[model samples]
Target: MSLLEQLNQDMKQAMKNKEKDKLAVIRMVKAALQNEAIKSSHAELSNEEELTVLSRELKQRKDSLLEFKNADRLDLVEKTQAEIDILVDYMPEQLSEEEVSEIVKQTILDVNATSKADMGKVMGALMPKVKGKADGSLVNKLVLQQLS
Candidate 1:
């Protein structure tokens, strides 16, 4: 099933099980997806578009998680972390650090990226291959390590 279909099925199950947190997350994600679709003037989103929306949602929650942590707000931190956990369930399986590093190494070579000057070239060619699968900062770190 597509992401939307899977979300619908899980939403129904969450309701049946009285899982309020899970249900709420699912509904929120659904609304985000629908909103994105409407913005793009499409009735249905392609897989790439859905992934973009999911990533945006996940990133927002993660940023919130970081701010909450910095402000020492344990309550908000925990709440944001829980929301992040729910968002992750719908994301593609994350690429391991090792796996991402290997891909970074290969991409660097493929693009002939020899120094930090080529960071843009390497990343432009790399992000499409790893988008939604690996963390951006991790990818940037790996690429910088390889380049420098």
Candidate 2:
């Protein structure tokens, strides 16, 4: 099933199961997807577009988790972590750091990137290959490490 269809089915199941937290997250994702469609003037989002939305949601949750941790708010941290877990369920399987490093290394070769000056070139060529599979920040770090 497509991600949107799966989300709709899960939303119903959440309501039936009285899973308040899960239901809320599902609704939020649905809203984001709908908003994206409206913004792009598209009737429906492709799976790739849905994945982009999912990744954005996941990034937001992770940022919140970090802030909560810094504030020593255990309750908020736990809740944010739960939200992150829910978002992750819909994401494509993430690449390991080693796998990302390998791809970055190859992309560097493909783009003939040398030194930190070519970071942009490397990233431009690499992001599409790794999108939805690896986090951008992680890829950036790997690229920097490989280039330096």
The candidate maximizing TM-score is 2
Across 24-138, the per-residue lDDT of candidate 1 in tens digits comes to 8899999999999999999899999999999999999999999999999999998889999999988999999999999999999999889999999999999999999999999
The alpha-carbon lDDT assigned to residue 40 of candidate 2 equals 91
Model 2 lDDT tens row, 1-148? 9999999999999999999999999999999999999999999999889999999999999999999999999999999999999999999899999999999999999989889999999998999899899999999999999999
lDDT over C-alpha atoms for residue 122 of model 1:
95
Shift in Å, residue 10, candidate 1:
0.9
In model 1, what are the clashing residue pairs, if there are any? Answer: none
Give the true-structure RMSD of model 2. 0.7
Q: After superposition, how far is residue 26 of candidate 2 from its true place, in Å?
A: 0.2
Backbone collisions counted per model: 0, 0
> What's the lDDT for residue 147 in model 2?
97
